[model samples]
Structure formats: structure tokens, C-alpha cells
Target chain A: MFIEFKDVSFKYPNNDKNVIDHLSFTLEKGSMLAILGHNGSGKSTIAKLIMGLLKATSGSIYICDTLLDEKSIDDLRQKMSIIFQNPDNQFVGVTVKDDIAFGLENHQIPRQEMLEKISKYATLVDMMAFLDANPENLSGGQKQRVAIAGALAMETELIIFDEATSMLDPKGTKEINAMIKKLKNEHNKTIITITHNLEEALFADRVMVINDGKIVLDGSPQEVLKEQTILEASGLKLIDGIAIIKEIEKTSLLSKENKEKICEALWELTFKM
Target chain B: MGINFQNVDFKYAKKASHKQLDNVSLNIDEKDEFIAIVGHTGSGKSTLVQHMNALLFANSGNITIFDTKVVRNKKIKLKPIRKHVGLVFQFPEYQVFETTVLDDIMFGPKNFGKTTDLAKELAIKASQLVGLDEELLTRSPFTLSGGQMRKVAIAGALAIDPDILILDEPTVGLDPKGKIELMELLLAMQNKTHKSIIIISHDMNIVAKYTKRIMVMHSGKLVFDGSKEALFNNEALLKEYNLDLPTAAYLAKELKAMHLIDYDSLPLTKEELTHIILGDSCNE
Candidate 1:
């Protein structure tokens, strides 16, 4: 496993609540995993814990078989970069170009090399036009793209998106999704996305549902979404394709008609009927 | 007769920037109804709603809200329009300026010249409406959790007893339960007070389920204004405007693909969608 958590429990220094409690999971190299849950489900907390933003109260995390401690932080952090839920909170530079350079600066690449990486990623996320644009002046979607470009420019082995698409419109979201997919395929980067929009999870290799600070469900997207009760209680939705199958199971139609209606509905719903 | 905008035009003249909103006209019915104005970010969605209250008066043309004319040429007393139409911004954290929760909720009512006692009374009612506990009322506004703080800010808006309450992305960053609770509270408010509720959100699922109508804004124009069913029925159109059907509607459409559903009308909720898929067996 590239990243593994062994019974990790995290509680804020003085807070009573264990934001993430005794949860353990793993992400293999070059694998895409998605965490699905409703608000306050500790989804973002888990991401923060992995990134070493918050210290765990108990247990430990291992990166590539190395126990996570203060010493390995520099190396572990290099392998990981996180995009927060709010684009505005994470922005640090005045211009889009400068923001992307923040990461290259950390890696200590020379000015020319840094500019090369920044220019490359800016075009990748379709932000070349906004490269000179002010970060605060860009629209929500544009801000998110610039943020993504900054992370990608760092060449982090693992990319964590904490509802990164939530701030974007549909077109912007689809663009980011396509970019994430391409990175996982071409660059072989491990992608972990924490999102409430369940539909986006359809493209994930696997979906894991976290509730009440625990990982209650983890499986292929199809398997997990098939369980209606668990999804409803967690406030997540099944992917569009699978959601229709479950809906058809509830009603008792005539034997021959049953097969027919299911087909008709799928066609109509999928843009054919 | 509640609000009217005739040939309203506004231009933000940056040193080199061009116009934001071209000449546009719209009329809003005051009686109990919900309105959602959606557009890509910077498409003038926020700019237009800011006009509902006296936040930004039109540079040109006639404007009216709650029988009060408001434009560059109209009466400048914005106090009444703001009181009647509360515009809840996207991020409550930016809007919350008070020290304590109680003080925050009292800000709007206090600004409206209500006595301290009346402001407190309104605060309590608004707090209950948003599911905020009385215990948290004394705590610092910044100390509360994200979900709780969001409710407190909304409670502050509700304290003024706005006949038409407008919220922009009330559920952003919230968990599913929090989103559901907020939606239910808004629905409850609309039910009891018959107050007009307008919500601007990117969540198609929420829009499909709760909203009776939608107003799609694009490039500073009102592109589509109609029922949710009509919008979902035209998935291609929604995509053209950079939108998609909700998960439920997406499912309904998929089931239709398999010849499971006959009606083309898009149902908002999963319950309604289940019946549509079951066809005659919907009740069962």
C-alpha cells in the first residue's frame, strides 16, 4: 500500500468529539479511491490526517511501509498534496502563476524550471489564459482549476480533492474530472476524492462510505450503491445508472410488462427513449 | 405587484472591463413562491439578486420591490426593501460580523430599529427556525461549528421577518443531513409564513427536489425560467447551459431508456421516480 492507516483516531486537542475514530484504510499506488459521505462525516478530517495537517490522537499511518513520524514527514508530504473544499481559503499567491509557483518553490526548483512546470500545468488544467490573471478576481471554477494546477505542478504522487468540484459549475466540474482521470491513467497518480455529489463517484475505481467517524462501507461503486438503506442513512446517492435498477425492483408489475417498463425507463432516462 | 424591474441595466466599468448586465426586464410575483436564479459564477447571478434588496440600485431603468420604487432615480431609503427581502450571501462567515450568536441574530432586527426586547424575541424565533440551540446563543459566533455557524447567520437574516427570503448556496460544504435540515426549514418557513423563498445553488439534486420553479441565468441574461420537470426533460439544453439532471432525474431517464417508464415528465424525488418507473404499480 502506498498509504495505510492502522486504527487511526483523531481528536482535536481540547474538543470532545473524535473527528475521526479508530478508522483504518489503505490506498495502493496508482489506484483511485473515493470517499462518499454527508456533511460532518469526518471525510475531510481523514484527508487532513493523511496529509499530516492534524496529529492523530492514537494509532499510526504508514507510507510505503515506513511508519509515519516527524522524521518521514518531508518525504511523506512530498508524495501527497491536498485541495481543500473552499478554493478561497487555500489561495496564497496574488496571480495564478504565482500560486502555482508556491509548490515549485517548496521543491526548490530553479526559477526557469519552476516556470516550465507552472506553464505546463496551467495549460493542462486550461488555465493558461488566466496565468496572468489575479487569483481573487477569477471566478469560482477558474480558482479551483488554478488550485488544481498548483498541485499538479508539484508532481505529488497522490492527489486528494476535498470536494474540489463543489465550487465549480457542471462544465468546470466535468473538465476537472476529465483531468483527474487523465492523470490517473497517463501519469499513474493515485487519486482520492472526498465528495458529497455521489454521481461523481461513478468513475472511481472503488467507493468507500464513512459515517460517524467510521468506515462502514467499502466496495466497488456498484456494490455499495446497491444497498439503499445504508446510502439513504448516510445521505449519499447511488450513481445514475445503478439508481434506476434499484428503483425498478420496488414495484410489482406484470411478469412480461416488468421487463418492458425497465427497458423503456432506462432508454428514456439515458437519452434514447 | 411585489417587485418589478423594467429595462434595468448596470455596468461595472473597470479601467478596461466591459459591461456586466445588459438591458434586462423582470417582474417578481410577491405571493408565496420560490425563485432560483442560477448562472455560471460571474454570470451576474449575485449582481442581480443584490438588486432585490437596495444593495445595488440599477444604473438605469425602473425598479420596484414590495411596492417601493428602487433605482438610481427612485427613493434612496433602502431600509424597507432590505427588511422585506433578506439576501443571504454565499458564505455566511463573511456576512457574520457580530461577536456572539445572540448579537449576530439581533443585528438585522436591531438595524431595522426594533427595541432590544423585540430583537431578542425575534432572535429566539429565528434560532428555533434554523435548529440552533439556545445554549449556543451566548457563545462566540466564530466558536461554533461550521454547520451551526451557518444556521446562526441564517437565523440572523430570518430575525428581520423578511417576507421574501433569499439564500445563496446555503448547503455548500455541509453534510447531507445538514443540507436536508436547512431545506426542510426553508420549506417550513414558506408553508407557515407564505413567504417567498429564493435559493441560488449549484446542487441540481436540491433544485430538482425542493424548488417549484427555476430561473436559469447565463451571460447576464435570463435563459430559462420554468418548472423543474421541463428543465430535466431537456437534458441536452441543461448541458448546453452547463447543468445536468439530478441523480434521481438521471435515474428516471435511465429507466426510461430500458422501456420501464412511459411518461417523459421528470419527477423530482426518488419516491415519485420509483412510481414513474413502476408505471401503474407506482402506488404499490
Candidate 2:
């Protein structure tokens, strides 16, 4: 497993109840996982735990077969990168090129190699044209692209997107979604996306839902999303067409076989559309 | 009366090549108006809404807010216009700076010259309107959950009792249920107060489900402004503006293409689409 959480549990210092309660999961290399949950469901807490920003109250976390402890924390983090929700808060440099280079410089890549890596990753995210442009002047989507470039330039084995597209417009969201797909397929990077958007989750290889800091559903998107009751209970919903199908399921108008056929047809149709 | 804009144009900088709002004209009623303004990022949706409360004066033409008239480069008492139109910015949670939720909610009413006691009263009422718990009002706003913080911020906007309310991408970060609840709350508030509501959203589903009027901006131009049906049905306008169909509308289009379902107008909600799909079965 590329990443594993073994009976992982976390609790805030001031809170009595555990925020993450006996959670366990595994992610294979080069596979994409989408973590869906409502506000304060401890979705972000999972990310922070993985990034070693917060210590677990109990249990253990393993990355690349190495136990995440005080000694291994820095080493494990070097193999991963995180993109936060707010694009404005993430920029570390004045220009796009400088922003991407900041990470490379931290890893102490030689000056010549850093320049080449910056151009390569920037081109991969389609932000090559805006290398010299000021980060403040870029659109939300463009800033996120630069953030992606920065993450990719680090050459990390894993990338975590923590509500990365929540602040963007539809076009920006689409752009970032496409980039995530490309990263998994072409770049062979293990990716974990934390989002409330079910539409974005549809593309993930696996989907895990959280509710009140507990894993409510864990399976492929098809399997997990079909449990609309569970999703709704967790402050989530199936994407539009599937949601409509779920509503149709309650009505006795259609025969069982016909309902199944319509479900398949509508699901495929909605995706293609 | 309400708000009217006639050939309004605005530029962020005097030397800027393009106007943020170019030759935009529109009318909004003070009562019973639910309008959604949508466009791509940096397409002037934000700029257009900011003009409503006199946050940004026009570079040309004029804006009439009730009895007040605002012209280019003309200074007026913005307090009255602001009092009449409450603007809730994007990520309204960031705007909460007071120690307690109640203080934050009361800030708006206080700024508008309400007495301390009256502001507290209005704040409590507004908090209740947003479905906020009374216990949370006394807690630090920072300690509340994201949804609760958002409600607190909205309560701040509502405390002033504005005739018109404007929200910029209010549902951006909320979960599915939160999004629906917030929209329902806004709808209920509008119905109860008979005040106009304006939202700038990137979510087509929310716009299709909530707002009656749709305004599309592209390249700083009001390319299309009409009913949701007209805007969603116009393929060319949608393509030109880089707008997407709401999920129900898109599903309807796909179903029509497959020759499985046919309709005169696109369904904008799941309920509407389900009705069309199930047909007589639904009625039965």
C-alpha cells in the first residue's frame, strides 16, 4: 500500500469526543481516492494527520511502508505535497515561476536542474505561458494550476488536494479535475482529493465518505454513491442524474427490471452528456 | 421602486483598457425578486453586484437606488444605499472578526446606527432567521463549525434588515445539504420579508433551482438577461458565454437526444426531470 491508516483515531485537544474514530483505509500506488464529507466531518483532519500537521490521538499511520513517527515525519512528508482550498493563501512567491521554484529550492535541487523542472511541470499544467506573470494577477483557476505546477515540480509520489476546487468557478473546477485525471494516468501519482462535490468524486477509483469523523461508506464510486440514504445522512448527495434515479427508486411506478435498466441508461447518459 | 442601472460602465483603473462593467443596464425590484448573476471568473459578476450598494460608482451613465441617483465620479451619502442593500461577500466566514457570534451579528445593525439594545434584538432575530442556535451566539465565532460560522455571517447581513440582499457565491464551500438548507433559508427569508435577493453563483444547479431571473455576463458585458428557461434553452448564448446547463437540463437534453424523452422546455430540477421521465407513472 502506498498509504495506510491502521485504526487511526484523532481528537482535538479541547474536544471530548474523538474527531476521527477508529478509521482504517489503504490506498494503492497510482490510484486516485476521493474523500467526501460535510463541514467539520474531520475530512480535513485526515489530511492534516497524513501531512503530520496533527498527531493522532491513537493508532498509527504508514506511508510507503514507513511508520509515521517523530523521526520519520519529515522524510515521509518530503515524498508528498498538499494543495489547499484557498489559492490566494498558497502562493509563496511574486511570480508563477518563482512560486514553483520555491519548493524545488527547499529540496535543494541544483539551480540548473530546478529551472528545467520548473519549466517541465509548468508546461504539464498548461501554465507555461504565465511563468513570468504575477501570481496575484492570475485567475483562481490559473493560480491553482500554478499550485499544481509547484506540487508536481516537487516530484512527490503522492498529492493531496484539500478542497482545492471549492473556491473556483465551473471552468476552473473542470480544469483542475482534468488535471487530476491527467496526473493519475500520465504522471502515475497517487492522489487523494478531499471534496464536497460529488461530481468531482465520480472520477475517483475509490470513494470514502466521512460522517462525524467516522467512515460511513468505503468502496468504488458506484458502490458507495448508490447508498443515497447514507450519503444524505452524511450531509452529502449523489450527483444530479443519480440523485434523480434515487428519487425514482422510491416510486413504485417502474418494475424492478425496468428500474435497473433506466438506472444504467441514465447513469451512462448523464456522464456522456 | 428598487434599483436601476442605465448604461453603467466602470473601470478599476483610469488607464485600464477595458471596462469591468461595460454598458450594463438592468432593473431590480425591491420586493419579491430572486435574481442570480452568473459568469466565468473575472467576468464582472462581482463588479456588477458591488455597484448595487454604491460600493463602486459608475464610470458613465447613472444608477438610481430608490430615491437616490448616483452618477459617475459623483459622491453621495452611501450610508443610505448601503442600509437598503446588504452585501454578503464571498467566503463570508472570513468577515467574522468579533469575539462572539452575537457581537459579529450585531455589528452590521450597529454600523447602521441602531441602538445597542435594538441591535442586540435584531441580531438575535437574524440569528434565528438563519437557523443558528442561541447557544452558539455566546461562543467564540472561531470555535463554531464552518456551516455555523457561515450562518453567523449571514445573520450579520440580515441584522440590518436591508430591503435587498446580495450574496457572492454563498454556497461555494458548503456541503450538499448545507447548500440546499442555505438556499431554502434565503428563499424563506425573502418570502417573509418581501425583500429582493441577489446571488452571484457559479453553481448552475443552485441558480436553476432557486432564482427566477438569470443574468449572464461575459467579457464584462451583460450578454443575456431573462428567465432561466430562456437562458438555459438558448444553446448559442450558453456556448458563447461559456455557461453550462444545469444537471437536470443537461439530462433532459441527453434524454431527448436518445429519443427517450421529449419536452418543450428544459427541466431545471431533478423533480421536474423525474416527472418528465416517469410521465403518467408519476401521476399515477
Candidate 3:
């Protein structure tokens, strides 16, 4: 496994209860995985654990077959890049271009080559027009684009989005979602997304539903979201495709089997629409 | 008028600025209605909402909240105007500065000149509105769960007893249950106080299901304003704004196109869609 969570359990420092408990999962290389759950479900906790921001209390996590430890921590981060929820919190540079170059600078890439990478990423996220803009001047979504450009420049093998879309508007939300899909499809990089917008997960190859510090459901959106009762119990509802399924199921015009096929076809229809 | 924006344009204080609000005009009725202002990032949605309470003044044009225009008006006091309009910034937990939950929530009321006794009463009531257990009143706000802390901050806004409440991305970063509970509490508050509520959000599905009046912004322009149905019907407008129609609204349109459902009616929720699909004759 490129990344594996082996029955890992974790608690924030000094906290008695584990935020992530008995969590075991695997991410194959180049597969975009969506992690879904409500607040306090330990989804973000799982992200922090993978990013080496928190230590696990039990079990083990392996990234690229390497055990996590202080000696390997820096190297681990070098290969894994994470985009946090708050765009402002992650910005380390003054201007968009400088910000994109921050990571490359840390990696000790020369200025000349780093400039090329920064420009490339800026264009990739459609922030080329704002390359010289101050980070604080940009809106949340614009700032996030810069953050994503910075992360993309790192070209990390595994990318995790910790509710990165929460602050963006609908168009901004779609823009970033498309970027994630592009990364997975064209770049051959593994992706992990923690989001409440289950609609965004339609294109994802796999999704894991976590709750109460444990993964409650593990499957495709078809396997999980098709069951509205299960989703609602977890404070979620069917998103795009599954929503169509539920709608068609109500009509009684289509059999349960047809409903599934139509739901499966939502992606194709959405693209054409 | 509950809120009004006229030819309002604002650029954030820094340079290399994307115009946050550009030549936008809007009018919100005095009817105690639930309104949602939704747009993608850099769409001027926040700029418009902030203008409601004078947190960010318009660079040009006028802003009127309630009956009085927000200028150097001698007739209406700005302090009282601010007290009448309470604004809750996003991730409100970060604004918690008091030692305890009760004290934090009471800060606004006390600052607005309510007695400590009255402030405490209001705090307790506000906490209940947001579904916080009273035992947490004495607990440190810093130590509470993220969801609980958000409720505490929202309760802070509630303490002022505002006539109008504007929340900027109030539901962001919350789990769905927390988001729904908060929304329900706000709805309850709206019922009890008859206060006007404005929610600034980017999520179309949320806006579709919750608000009575919908406003769409893009490129700092107020692109569309009307009912949720109208907003969804204007696919060209929604597309021009770079926003996706709410999946329900979008799917309903598709089903209508396919002759699978009613073309004129847009279903806002899954339950409604189910009713339409199953021919249950029950309105969800």
C-alpha cells in the first residue's frame, strides 16, 4: 500500500477519548479517495495523523512502506503535501508568486527553476493573473487557489485536502473540485479529500465514512450513499448521483435496478449537461 | 427596508485587489424573512453582508439597515444601529475571548449597556437557543468542542437582541448535524423574534433549501436576486456566475426536460423529490 492506516487510534494531547479509533484503511497510488463524515467525526484528525501533525496512540501508519518516526518525519512531509481548511493559516509568503515559491525554497530548489514551477502552478489554478497580488488582499477562494498552486508545485505523491472547499463559493467550489480530479487523472497522484459536500465525491474512486473516531462505512458512493437512511443518520444525505437514484426510486417508474444504473450514469449526464 | 445596497463598490484595503463589490444594487424588504446571499469566492458576497452592519462601509453609494440610512444621521444613533444589527463572522469560535462561555456571550449585551443581571439572563436564554447545555455556562469556552464553541459565539450575537442578524459563512467547517442544528435554532429565533436573517453562503443546495429570498453574486456583481425557483431557472445567469445549480434544482430541471417529472415545479429537498417521483400526493 502506498498509504495504510492499520487499526490506528489517536487522541489529541491530554484528551482522554480517542479522536480516531480502530481506523484501518489503505490508499492505492493514484486513486482519489474521499473521506466523509460530520463534525467531530475524526476526519480531520485522520488528516493530521497522516500529515504527522499528531502521533497515534496505538497501531501504526505506513506511508510508502516507511514507518513514522522523528528520524523519518521530515522526509515523510517532503513527500506528502497537505492543504488545510483555512487558506490564511497556511500562507507563508507575502505575494502570490512568493507564496507559491515558499515550498520550493524550503526544498532548496534554485530560484530560477522555482520561478518556472511557481508560474506553472499559478497558471494551472488560473491564478496567473494574480501572481503578484498580496495574499491578504485576495478573497478566501483566491487565496485558496494560491495555496493549491503552492501545493501542486511541490508535486507531492499523496495530497490531502482538509475541507479545503468549505470557504469557496459554488463556482470556486467547482473549480477546485475539477482541479482535484485533474490531479488524480492527469498527474497520477493519490488524493484524499475530507469534505461535507458529498456531491464532490461522485468522481472519486473510493470513499470512507468515518464517525466517532472510527470508520463506520467503507465503499463507493454507490455502496454507502445509495442508502439514504444510513447517510441521514450520520447527518449526511445523498448528493448528486445518489440523489437522482432516490428521486427515480420515488417515481416507481423505474425498478430498483434501473435506479442504480441511472445513478451510476449521473457522472456521464452531469458532464454532458 | 431591512437592508439596501446601491451602486456599492468596495475593494479590500490592500492592492492587487479584485473588486470585492462592483456597482451592485440590492434591496431587502422589512418583512422578517430568511435571506441567503450566495456566490463563489471573490464574488462580493461577504462585502455585501458586511455592509449591513457597517463593519465595512461602501466606498460609494448608500447602505440603509432598517428604516434609517447608515450615514452621519443625527436622528439614529450608530451604536444603537449596530446593536440592532448583529453580525457573526465565520468560524465564530475564533472570536471567543472571555474566560467562560457565559461571560463571552454576555460581552455584547453588557457593552450595549444591559445590566449584568439582564445580560446573564439573556446569555442563558441564548445558549439554550443554540442547543448548548446550561452546565457549559461556567465552563471555559476554550475547552469546549468546536461545535459547542461555535454555538457559544453565535449565542454572543444573540445576546444583543438584534432586530436583524447577518451571519457570514456561519455553517462553514461544521459537521452536518451541527450545521442543521444551528440552522434550526436560527429558524426558531426568527419565529420568536420576527427578526430578519441574512446568511452569506457559497453552497447553493443550502441556499435553495433554507432561504426565502436568494441573491447571487459573481465578479463582484449582483447577478441575480429572487426566489430559489427563479435563481435555479436562470441557468444562464447561474452559469455566468460560475456557480453550479443546486443538485436538486438541476436534477429537477433535467427530469422535467426528460418528461419524467413536472417541468414547472422545482423540488428543493429529497423528500419533495421523492413525493414527486413516487406520486405519493404528499407534500414533503
| Superior by TM-score: candidate 1 or candidate 2 | 2
Candidate 3 local lDDT, A135-160, one digit each (tens) = 99987778888888998899888889
**lDDT of the candidates, in the order given:** 0.80, 0.90, 0.79
DockQ of each: 0.48, 0.70, 0.41
Identify the CAPRI category of the predicted complex in candidate 2: medium
Q: Give the winner by DockQ.
A: 2
TM-score of each: 0.91, 0.97, 0.88
Q: What does candidate 2's lDDT look like per residue over A1-273, in tens digits? A: 989999999998887999999999999999999999988888999999999999999999999989999999999999899999999999899899999999888879999999999999999999999999999999889999999999999899999999999888888888999999999888899999999878878889999999988999999988887798899889886688988788778878876766676677788965654
Please give, as one word, the docking class of candidate 1: acceptable
Q: Which docking category, incorrect, acceptable, medium or high, applies to candidate 3? A: acceptable
Ranked by DockQ from best down, the candidates are: 2, 1, 3
Candidate 2 lDDT, B176-272, residue by residue in tens: 8889999999999988889899999989999999999999998789988899889998999898888889988888887778666677777999889
lDDT score, candidate 2: 0.90
- For model 1, what is the error of residue A72's alpha carbon versus the real structure, in angstroms, after optimal superposition? 1.6
